[model samples]
Target: MNFKSLKTLAVNGKQVIVRVDFNVPIKDGRVIDPSRIQAALPTINFLCEQKCRIILLTHLGKPKATHDPACSLQPVFEYLAAILPGVKFAPIVPGTAEAITRSQEVRPGDILLFDNLRFHTGESENDLDFAKNLAALGEIYINEAFSVCHRKAASVSTLPTLLPSAAGFQLQKEVEFLQKIMEKPQRPFIGIIGGAKISTKLPVIRALLEKVDYLLLGGALANTILKAQGIAVGKSLIEESMVSEVKDLNLVTNKLRVPIDVVMAPSVEPDALSQTVAVANVPDEQRILDIGPETLELYKMILQTAKTVVWNGPMGYFELPQFEQGTKQLAEIIAGLNAETVAGGGETLEAINQLKLNDKFTFLSTGGGAMLAFLEGKPLPGLEPLTIE
Candidate 1:
């Protein structure tokens, strides 16, 4: 974590290779959300100011060695050129020796973007030869891709072994921002953790239990908790083994709030039969899909009182319009908060955007698995190798 940032690196005459997360959503060959590209702008702009020769590297979509046209980075190159007209694109096809030779021609203040790394088998496999070839392109390396920091790939995990590496502004910011919560946060640090499975989120929930003053559980996991308490959860999904853990954690009490009522449906589809029922008295044939209004009110009060709040995942099946009300309300509550609010995960971001509250939070992390892995006190391979000196 003691890696040198852009501030410590001299870029006036150096060929700087920056690893950024430009894996944005694409539809009809158009970039839908430019948030990931925008997140790396501070570093991009800074390096430009320093007159550094910029070599941008990123993976677009999952592409095999045969090169799928749909996974090409050509559209990304076009989008970036529009965002930064001064930065010229120098294409480097992955796996080709020509890539290194092409990189040799890069001049100071010029910007080059390499093609999709996944198109080359070595990139994903962490081939040493490929790493050395990539390292030869730059005098220094800057990792700004927090979203892919958890992966131990050739570019992110191995390239640093051959060249001096540093953390970019975006990576440093994400570390510093999350570090605040790792340390003892302000009093009433409420945490809301939700998603579909108890098995998947068990580690996060266990970790938060030791720190958070209040923990709110919802979504499919809430049904499991309710079922464990001997309450009728109906046709909702339940993890039978988690009942003991839920009981041991004392989640039945006020410290960890589960829904008192839930919005139930026969199926997850929008056209399914739906109704709301008390959690304790759910019908045997109905499947609970979302938290009821009463639960939203309880969660809102906790949000209002929190000085620092960290949230991940959706409170309900937010993709469905009928079940979106609870998640939407939660986003509204988060939007109105004056506290330091940090949200992560794909569903959480979607709910925030749907509620038109993306700008309201203190920070919206671009990472998903990387964020959760970091929160669990695990090391990120892409970030661990970078040194401050």
Candidate 2:
């Protein structure tokens, strides 16, 4: 939980390797979401102010170590070049003779963004020797990629051990804000936890139940929970195996608030005839995709009374136009509230962007898996390596 801050480190005229999360969405070879890149600017700018030769380490997409052009960081590099004039791109990745020569050639204030780290299988395997090669390129290591901090990759995990490591500005802020919610959030705290499945969110959900007053459920997890109560969810996505676990959870927790109604359809198609139906009245062939209008109204009233609201995951299948309404409406409602709000996860970010309500929340966390892990009171692998003994 404790790590050195980047500003506290002495990196004047040093080659600093910064692990940033530039794993943004790309469409037709163009970066669609530059929020991750923008979030990293403060630390990158600060490193430049300290006259550090900023060597940026990041992965774009899931590449199978073949240096696939489709999974390239070239668009990100081009964006950086436009925003940051004179930024350099290494011709080769680490572990090569040319990469070694390139590392020595960088001057202070110069920026060097290497090719995708995932291009080498060693990065994800946490290969210490490969980490050592990466560390050899810099005297200091900075991890600003809290989104990927949950991953035990060589660049984020082992590389920090070989060099002086510090948490980047964005990461420090993420810890501070998320810690605020976990430790001492304001009175009448309301948590809205939803997503595709109950499996991925189980730990955080259990953790939230201990802290939040009213925990509202949405998405397919709500369907699974409903199924446990013997309610007919039609042909909705239900984790049948997790039904018994939900029964046990219900016996323990009274703070959970499930959807009273849901938007149902015969299929997941865009043109599937949708209808708002009571949770108990869903037809045998209908799939539940979104929260109903009544549930939205209930959530709005509950969110309005809260002093602090912590939200994660979309309330519905927001990527689909029909199912986006519930998530969209709730986003606007939260935007209008005076609560000190905090949100995390990729889908949550997507919803926030869909509504352009980013400025309304107190903190829109950059940490994804790291944020969830932190919320669950668990230590992150990428962060553990940065801690002082």
Clashes of 2: 0
Q: Per-residue alpha-carbon lDDT of model 1 for 1-389, expressed as tens digits?
A: 46677787666778899999888888899887777899899999988888888889899878755577888777788898787856665555654689888888887767888888887888889999888888888898889998898898998899877787788888888888887786868878988878888877778787887788998888888777777778888888888888777665675467788887888888888698778878887888888888999989878877889888888878788778889888888888888988989988777877786667888999998887788777877788887787543
RMSD of 2: 1.7
lDDT of each: 0.82, 0.86
Give a tens-digit lDDT track for model 2, residues 171-263. Answer: 888887888787898979999988888887888888888889889989998888888988899999988888887775662454788888899
Give candidate 2's whole-model lDDT: 0.86
Best model per lDDT: 2
Candidate 1 clashing pairs, residues 3+ apart or interchain: 4-388
TM-score of each: 0.90, 0.96
